[model samples]
Target: MAEARAELQKKETELTNAILKDVSDIVDAIGYEGGYAVILRSEVVLSAKKELDITGAVIRRLNESKGKPKEAPKVKPKEKPKDKK
Candidate 1:
């Protein structure tokens, strides 16, 4: 029973670590600080603001580049009409 409990606890810890790593990766990719305050508590409003600011800047840059030539949208093939015999 003790071994089973220990194994379960270890698995829980591993899962928690994996979740933290994923959240950290997302925060880093979007240029935000990763922490419980940002993800859970509402005390980290400044961090959230900064993250939004960064995202807005990225979007603005992308929009500004829209004037450049881009590939045409792909057209879907038209289906042939069935013959009514």
Candidate 2:
């Protein structure tokens, strides 16, 4: 059980890093345009000021970046054969 939990945590960290990297790219692009110096990770901070919070914007941008969800594959139904007339 401990090993399973550790593995799950490791995967979660990897996924979090990937998401943060993508969001950071968007933030960095905007920051560079606005002449901002640097952006810090929210998690590392002890607390955040309201203006510094960009969680909503990041989520919206992430959704837009990913586009619409993909359609699931269709499944064929089984058919029965007719008897000789």
Best by TM-score: 2
Which regions of candidate 2 are displaced past 4 Å? 37-57, 70-85
Q: Clash totals for all models, in order? A: 0, 0
Instruction: Compose the digit string of candidate 1's lDDT tens values, residues 19-60.
Output: 667555554544554223334334545445544344454445
Give each model a TM-score. 0.40, 0.52
- List clashing residue pairs in candidate 1: none
Q: What lDDT is reached at residue 71 by model 2?
A: 100
TM accuracy, model 1: 0.40
Q: What is the lDDT of candidate 1?
A: 0.59
Q: Each model's C-alpha lDDT?
A: 0.59, 0.82
Worst 10 residues of 1 by lDDT: 33-42
Query: What shift in Å separates residue 43 of candidate 2 from its native position after superposition?
Result: 10
